[model samples]
Target: MLRLPTFQLHEPASLKEACALFAEHGAAAKILAGGTDLLPNLKHEIYDVDHVISLAKLPGITGFEMQGHDLVIGALTPLAQVATNPNIQKHAPALAQAASLVAGPQHRQMGTLGGNVMLDTRCQWINQSYFWREALGFCLKKDGTVCHVVEGGKKCVAAASNDTAPALMTLGASLTFVSATGTREIPIEDLWVADGINNKSARPGEILTEIRLPLRDHTHHGAYGKLRERGSIDFPLLGCAVRIDLDDADCVRDAAVSLVALQARPLLIKGVDALLQGLKLGSTELDQAIEAVAQLAHKKCKPLDNIPGDKDYRRRMVPVYVRRTLRAALDGTGPVHHI
Candidate 1:
């Protein structure tokens, strides 16, 4: 049986207390919202923490609300709540869809949105237990100096495993962070640093307070697609999220596409915004757009030896998923549930 290494547990009643605990513990401490990820890593001995700080009792952190044009999602909001919330479904269907696809019903019930956002993803070389890692002499993401996934590489090549990040990113999302220092807001896309070990720019003492999603205008439509080993329990091998705006005549006014599980950070397809601007969605235009996105994906993605699917197969599916998601959103087909 997998057993976690011994550690002291601390429960903070308020957000301030939580930040203070984090400041005190620093790298020796690991923040615990939902134990879905952290607990498993601990059991595998991948991380040995001196203390586990819990945020179960944080006040003023209840649910989601819309303030002006932003749909504010409280950090404590559970995955199930976000997935089934009527407001989220209506305002940010892509995010809702992504949340719904995470784990099973029981995991959804326990996992918080903040937990999902902060979930640590893995590569084949680094995901193993201590014994396995010892045999392999460790990988760059875990302990070794060189990345096993990328030959002679300095940076960790582990892929970004969060499902919601791509969905939120495509729709122009931002995050609210609270820390002992102060509070600040930044674009969700900017939160991720390309480096694998320290992927997030969030400070050790900062708590991810809320995620702010822009209210969807009637003219805009969006969708998300996840390609995993199965319909359940598996993390994504590749995924796509797309949002686009159409004019009265159904001509495209703007477009944003984000693909995840391909690299250390979600890759945004550039020139797509410019290419789709003022263009009408039709079979011909869509075909051309798909071709263009395919070129972009091919050029942008450098799939490594990680995850379940073959790198070549996963790489080829990027444009397929991207096109399907964009087409569905443009046609108003329906929500593409990750499950």
Candidate 2:
């Protein structure tokens, strides 16, 4: 059995104390949230840190509320709540669908929304037992220089496998960060850099405080589709999210498509507005636009052989999932997932 590395666990009573502890520990400290991802990584010896700052004592970061035109969610809110919350279902069904599809009931009960957002990039080569990785001489993500996914590759390409990221991106979300220094909020797009070795832009002493999602006055429809090996307890081989806003006449006003499990960052498919704009629901024009968007996604998304599934197969399923998700959005039937 894999064993977690030795570490000093620090549970702070408040954010002030937590930030101070982080500031003191610097690079040697790692934040512990739900322990869904972090603990497993620790067992695999992915991170060797001296201190683990637990947020269990921190308060006021575990619920959902509406602040003006935005749906503000506490970072520590359970995934089960996010999946079943009535407000989230009304305003951001795609996100709810994504949350519901995460792992299983027990995992959802333990996993937090913020934990899902901050999930690490995953790769088949690196996410293994120490002995298995040692036998293969490791890869770029961990203690090795070589990248097995690509021949002589210089950068790590571990795919981002978070289900909620694409859904939140399509919902036009932003995140708030707090530290001993102060607090700052940024669009979710800014949270990620392209490098898989260390993808987040969050600073060492910062704690993700909350997530904000904008609410529009227009009619909205959304869906999430995941391609995976099993219905539960499996991450996506390909994950797609679709969002389309309509006017009173049921014509498209704005649209977006975002995907994960493709690369180091969740991909926001480009030129979606150009194809989907002004198309009426239930019309041939809308159907044609959906097809065009799927084709466009297929052309833009290139899956590397970093995750468990066949990369080429994953590539082919991108359009298929995207198309199905878009259709489900229009039909008011959601989260087009395999069960």
Candidate 3:
């Protein structure tokens, strides 16, 4: 059995106390939420930490409710709760699907929304036992300079494997973060950075507190599609989330497409709305628009051979998955078929 290294545990009673502890410990401190991801990494000796700050005792960060015109989800809300929340299912079914599809039932019960959103970039070489990584001479994400995935690469190429980020991005979500110094809100897309070694843009001292989703109208629809190696307990090899708004005449007024597990950070496909706007859903022009969006997705998503599934096959699936997700969203069908 793998053993966790020695570390000081801090159970802060409040968010303020938690922020203070993080500020006091600085780089040596690591935040512990659901522990579904962090504990496994700790057992692998992926990174050493002198302090483990638990957020369990902090109140007001573990519920889901509607506030005015927005859906406010506390960051610490469990994935299971997020998946089953009636309001979320009604207003943002794509997020519900993403949350429900994460790992397995037990993991979904234990993993928090915050934990899922802040999931670390994953690579086949690095997400292994300590001995396993040591035998391969390590990678840039952990200790050594060289990246196993790329020849003489200057940066790590681990892929972002979060299931909910793309879904949340499609829903126009924003995050609220708090720290000892102050608090700020940023669009969900801004929460991710392009660097695999440090993929999240959250500062060292800030703690993500809540995720806010804008109000949706009757014409709005969304869908989430994920391709994984198995039916359950597997991270996504490629995931696509799409949201589109249709006018009275079935013409697309707005559309957004976001993809995960394709690169170091989840990407919002650029110019999707421009290509989709004013296009009727059932017209031949719609077929051309779909082709255009698929082509764009294929061009932008370049998967590396650092994770599960064939790199080339995963790349090829990008357009196929995007097309399927778009169809599901526009047709009011359920989640896209998983491959």
Q: Give the number of the best model, judged by TM-score.
A: 2
Ranking by TM-score: 2, 3, 1
Per-residue lDDT tens digits for candidate 3, residues 1-339, read 899999999999999999999999988988999999999999988877899999989999989877899989999999999999988877888898889889999999999999999999999988999999898798899978898889999888899999999999989999999999999999998888889888998998889999999978788888889899888899999989999989999899999999999779999999999999999979999889988999999998899998989999999999999998998887878577564
Q: Which prediction has more favorable lDDT, 1 or 2?
A: 2
lDDT of each residue in 1-339, candidate 1, tens digit only = 777888998998888888888889888899888788788788777775899998877777759888998889998798999999988877777788788887778888888898887878678777778888988798777667778777889888788888788888888889888887889999987888887776788877888889888887778787778888778877788877888877888888888888888777878877788767777777587668766876786677767776768999988887778778877777766355444
lDDT of 2 by residue, 240-269 (tens): 998999999889999999999999999999
lDDT of each: 0.80, 0.92, 0.91
Runs of candidate 3 with Cα error greater than 4 angstroms are none
TM-score result, candidate 2:
0.98
Estimate the TM-score for candidate 3.
0.98
Candidates 1 and 3 compared by lDDT, better number: 3
Deviation in angstroms for 60 in model 2? 0.7
**Among all candidates shown, the one with the greatest lDDT:** 2
Name the weakest run of 10 consecutive residues (lDDT summed) in model 3. 330-339
Worst 10 residues of 2 by lDDT: 214-223
Candidate 1 TM-score to native:
0.95
Backbone clashes in each candidate structure, one number apiece?
Answer: 0, 0, 0
Stretches of candidate 2 above 4 Å error? none
